[model samples]
Target: MFIQSQPADPAIHDKALRIANETLFIIRCLMREEEWGDYLREAYIIARRILEEKP
Candidate 1:
């Protein structure tokens, strides 16, 4: 017999969407600005990876 898969949790989904939306503005800013500090650069990289892997 095969097991069924579960859907994503509503709260978790909402949180993830919110995080993705929030990052868009900053990410766009990062695109225009030439000066990115170490922390911001790291955050941009992580955010890009997350967005790329989305279904």
Candidate 2:
């Protein structure tokens, strides 16, 4: 017997995609490590919290 996975809900997928894109943008900005030290640290913490809380 074989099992099949259910497709993701469109709304949830869109929300996850948006969050991922925003996180990627944050990471890109964070690559400028010198100028973004404290800001990057805060953003990282916030991102972590958001990801941890995600369903």
lDDT of each: 0.50, 0.51
What is the Å distance of residue 25 in model 2 from its true position? 0.3
TM-score of 1: 0.40
- Tell me the tens digit of each residue's lDDT in model 2 across 1-55: 1112433456644554566556657677546656455554455445444544546
- Which portions of model 1 miss their true places by more than 4 Å? 1-6, 30-55
List candidate 2 stretches off by more than 4 Å: 1-5, 30-55
- Tens digits of per-residue lDDT, candidate 1, 1-55, equal 1111433356644554566556655666656444434445455445444544547
lDDT of 2: 0.51
Candidate number achieving the greatest TM-score relative to the actual structure: 2
